[model samples]
Target: MTISRWKPNVTVAAVIEQNGKFLLIEEHTAQGLRLNTPAGHLDPGESPIEGCVRETLEETAHAFTPTALIGIYMARSSHRTGNKEDVTYMRFAFAGELGAREAGRALDEGIVRTVWMTADEIRASVSRHRSPLLLQCIEDYLAGKRYPLDLIHVDESVR
Candidate 1:
């Protein structure tokens, strides 16, 4: 018998804040209404922080300046994309400031709108979150979890 090794997919999330409210994207999913931070898969050639910044801008049409990393989260589940299978995700979350909103960039497909909500409001809407990490990241940020931007270092040759 052979045991197959499991590989968890990596994702990066951004938590942008303004005046004590968080920026969340409302997106339509097969499961109905869902809310999530500006986040997505870590594309090739981008570090977690860079990916977070990119995802935020893509999903929110706003510039994001990641000040600190929150924490990492891991989740596992089963779903059928066309066939039933187990899936896992490792998420890197960051808390930071949002720069000015761009004029012409469109929000990513499936994104309904962006909203600002307090942490308490987020906690109340837990059932509508796309993933548990949504609230976890917010809570962690509120708990004062912050890491220096210099923590992520990539060589210039990698660019």
Candidate 2:
């Protein structure tokens, strides 16, 4: 007899700001068109904060400096690649500042475009969000949500 193994994917979220506007992406989702912050799976050997900054820069063409971790989210969903494979994700959402955009940098694949939207505009687009947490993250950010950078402690042994 044989058994299968499962692993929960680790992901990072970036809540980027510029002149009071939040950076977001419009993407295609199983639920329909939806908006989301620049986010993606964490690469091996990279800390959550590093992953967040990398993803934000890749998707938005702007540098990101995560100041606080707003919240962590977990969800199970089917793969969109027609395999319909079940997958679970551990997402680290962070609030941060957006630095200058890089010239000649292209947005990551699957991202349509990066746009700046106010909290109210984000609220109005609830129906278009890739996930329910899209609006929730924004609301939390607007609510002054914050957690110390030290909140996430990575044991040096893991490095």
Candidate 3:
């Protein structure tokens, strides 16, 4: 019997807060319309921080500068159908500043719109969230948990 190595899919997310609300993306998914933070998979040759910044821009049409690492999260999903396999995602979530939106830029594919919601509002819409991490990241941010950006080390070789 041959053993297969398990590798979790690595992703990055931006936990952007303005006023008393957090930024979230509304997109179409197999499970239907769902809300998530500005997030996506890490791309080749990009640091996690860079990936988070890029994803935030692509999904929300706003520039993001990550200042602090909110938290790292891991979750498993068996609901994905096409691949017929269980998958785990390792997410690096960052707290950041959101800059001006690019004029007339369309959001990423499948993204219907961007919305801001208060923590209490988010808590009330748990059933509409794409993943539980969306809320976990926000709660962590609310609790004042943050790590310096220096905590992540990207090797020069990756560039």
What's the number of clashes in each of the models?
A: 0, 1, 0
* Top-TM-score candidate index: 3
Residue-level lDDT tens digits of model 2 in 1-159? 898788888989998766778889987766666699889899977889999999999988888999999998888766466566677878899998888889999988777888889888888888777766677777788888899989998777666
Which ten-residue region of model 1 has the weakest summed lDDT?
77-86
lDDT of 2 at 142: 82
Cα miss at 61, model 3 (Å)?
A: 0.5
The segments of candidate 2 whose C-alpha lies over 4 angstroms from its true place after superposition are: 1-5, 28-33, 79-81
Error of 3 at 3 (Å): 5.0
Name model 3 segments beyond 4 Å from true.
1-3, 80-83
Best by lDDT: 3
Angstrom error of the Cα, residue 54, model 1: value is: 0.9
Q: Which ten residues in a row have the lowest lDDT in candidate 3?
A: 77-86
- lDDT (CA) for every model shown? 0.89, 0.84, 0.95
- Candidate 1 has an lDDT of 0.89
